[model samples]
Target: MEFWTGLYLMSFLNMACCLPKSSYTVYLNKLSFSTAQSHCLPGSFLANIPKEEEMAEILKTIWDKNDKTATSFWIGLQKNKGDCYRKDLPLKGFYWTVDSSTQSDVKLWETEPSNTCLELRCGLLSVKYGETAATCNGFVETTCRQEHPFICKRNATVTCRRPDILGTHDIIDYSNDKDTCYVHCASGANFTLKCSKDLVWTVLGNQNMDTSQLCLECNKGYRRDASGYCVDVNECEESKPCTHRCLNTDGSYKCACSDNDMDDCDGSKPPTTDLTRNDYSNVNRGKSLLTQPTSLPDDVRTNETDVHIEESVGDVSNIIVPVIIALLIFIVLLVIVAAIVKGCIRRRTTKLSRRKAEAVALNGSNSMEKVNEKEET
Candidate 1:
């Protein structure tokens, strides 16, 4: 029992040992690369590229300081799941990012392990439990509590220069572990910060905070979290006016209603519209009787019709027999006139031609007789 108790105490001590009290105040705990962007220099190649040798060295240093040799630390080298790219040369840095320098070497691609290619960065596996190789993505069941060696870095201290206490919610607290603080923020609580090095969290916006942008209020609909994030207030039920559709946005809610209406005003009906042949779809703007009344267009045709009924009556008023008789008489008179005119013209022209012929014949006979007398004498 005594031996077990001693072991428990030692385990507790180790859990709290050598860990930085405040990461925000120190530089060693600063974040450079995560499961992603583990390799490559600051802003080089890409935010990706995991450095293997350096990561291994960090773990080695950690183990040395702890006076205990660990089997493995989570490394950022994932398997080469990129098909034929796996066979490409110079196996270094992060095999996942395909670092700019190595991309040219990729000639053929082979099918990658089903789960290998998708990760932004690979996890390092412990050499003791899993193989040093075996495609280390920390797959197959490994967690962070394994006491593997880890690397640590300190970040430059941030000081808030301007002090403002808009409210209790305006303050952001500084912590040794910004990652932990961020996690707290993700859980729906914001950090309350202060300016002094002692790191008391009660201070409002400290006069020393340099970045005013990062120091802000949780917008109207959102509330702050311990991690520094503004979480959305769950307003799916009432805050949204769009009863038809409620969409959850970053920090607020939105209501969306469909404009198309088929027939009945049933909100629950879907995939079908309610509309009549002559009725327009929208309930607010259906066919107005004032514009298109149920009456036929002919009922309201032009009302200025003033046809002369008296003229039609007068045209039928003539005595039938007398009118026909008058027409017959007029026709006979026209025939008689035409015949007389023709006869007169013919008689006149005949008389004139006959006289001309007779005169010529008589003159010829007289001249002949005179010629005979003169010859006999």
Candidate 2:
């Protein structure tokens, strides 16, 4: 039996036993058996009546046409010239052209063939006896060269509905054939699905729908490994963006300072006395301090401690230098004011002395004048 036919009978109980009623099409134009077979190509083939129910369906179709001129029709059953007859076989060495494995136990032949070993024979269904016959069995064996109207069978086109079980970043695409579907995931992975002839959808490689395997590009702070799995990215090992310490998380990273007193991870704090002493010792040992070292021994000073010491010394100098300059400026102004006061005192003393001398000279002149006037009188 055909795969679709068996599936319909076993799984889809609502459908007909063999091919569905809609699957068959009758062509009234008469043509040879080979020509008829060729006519149903690309998507269909000649009808295979492997069961009596299918033959009854074909007969009903012919009766519905109500054409008295139509008497016989070619089916898909045929026997090659070189094939030997097998009496024990259900089909007697004959096979359905559509599927050679098809078999039937129901005897629908009108009469047994006289030459059982004859070849190049094809199957035909005749209704000349009577349309209302109880058996409706009119299977006839005839030459391939005979011209007759034939029937073709094709599977109904069925669409596999889109699956809603996809991630937000997943994409779905249908192929030109419409039977194939491809799934693209954000993690740079892909899977395939196919619409089977029996109207069923199946995954191509039995792939699971897990998001871990479907993603192509991982989320932030995550990366794809060699085995195509999304793994956590260790930013601390790769870029070392932290100044003191680094910690890795599920999808991100964090930085931390070794000193508990420090508010941030940048190592920004004043150095203690021990740290200052160690910094000087390291400086005396002739170690280059231009670049900050990431790590140091217990005895040696760390670069962060050195930086704190340098900053503290710089801050002290920045304050003391300005105070000393202000004191010097104040002394210079005091000396200039004292010199002006001393010069003013000397000028005042000199002016006082000159006034005293002039006054004495005037007194002497006055006394002499008085004496001379007395002598004259």
- TM-scores for all predictions: 0.21, 0.36
Identify the runs in model 2 with alpha carbons over 4 angstroms from their true place: 1-22, 114-118, 129-135, 157-377
How big is the positional error of residue 230 in model 1, measured in Å on the Cα after superposition?
2.9
- The whole-model lDDT of each prediction reads 0.40, 0.66
User: Per-residue CA lDDT of candidate 2, range 1-377, in tens?
Assistant: 69888887777665444433445778899999999988876456888877777777777777766676777888888878877666676666778997686488556667654355546888787675365532355667789898999987764443456644445445466544565666665655565666543334455644332333444456878875533456898877888766555666688766554434333332322222234445555554645643434344433455556666877899999999999999999999999999999999999989866755665577786755665565469
Q: Write the per-residue lDDT of candidate 1 for residues 1-377, one digit (tens) a residue.
A: 99999999999899767443322111122232342233222222211123444334444444344332344343333343342324335433234333334422322122232333443433333332222322222222122223233232222233324344333334333455332221122223444444343322332344343323334556777765444445677776545444355556566655444444322222332223223322331322434533554442332211111123433455677667678999999999999999999999999989866765665577786755665565468
Model 1 earns a TM-score of: 0.21
Pick by TM-score: which candidate is best? 2
Would you give me the overall lDDT of model 2?
0.66
For candidate 2, the 10 contiguous residues with the lowest summed lDDT are 265-274
Name the weakest run of 10 consecutive residues (lDDT summed) in model 1. 298-307
The top-ranked prediction according to lDDT is: 2
- In the order shown, the candidates' Cα RMSDs to the true structure are 21.0, 20.0
